[model samples]
Target: MNITVKLFATFRAGRFDIESRTYAEGTTVGDVVRELNLSEKELGIMLVNSRHVKLDHRLEEGDTLSLFPLLGGG
Candidate 1:
């Protein structure tokens, strides 16, 4: 299965063009993040098909997912 991912902030450092990636079927958002060697704190937000989703959210083929970093302002 394939999924489109949009990386933001620190996550964008290693990649370009918020492109699509291929993964095994039944993979969850959390699985990919870990496989990518990213930490939970680095995954500030997870959006699935335009809605906020938890790490447990299972991904489907062709699903669009976005990951954002934690924002802090005083």
Candidate 2:
């Protein structure tokens, strides 16, 4: 399956802001994160096709997954 991944804020440093990736039929969100060498603790919010989802959420063909890092500021 093919999915679109969008990285926001600090997550885009040294990496693409958006990319299209191919994965197996049963690939989960966490699988994609690991493929990108990102730890779950580094993630803040996750959205699949505009809906919030958990790391264990399964991805579907043509889905758009947006990942955001934990933001901090006063």
Q: Write down the TM-score of every candidate.
A: 0.89, 0.93
Which residue pairs clash in candidate 2?
none
lDDT of 2 by residue, 1-74 (tens): 89999999888888899999889999999998888887678799999999999999999999999999987768
What is each predicted model's overall lDDT from 0 to 1? 0.86, 0.92
Positional deviation of 42 in candidate 2, in angstroms?
1.7
Model 1, 1-74: lDDT tens digits are 99998888888887754888999999999997887777798668889989999999999999998988888768
Off by over 4 Å in 2: none
Best by TM-score: 2
Hey, what RMSD does candidate 2 come out at?
A: 0.9
CA RMSD of each candidate after superposition: 1.2, 0.9
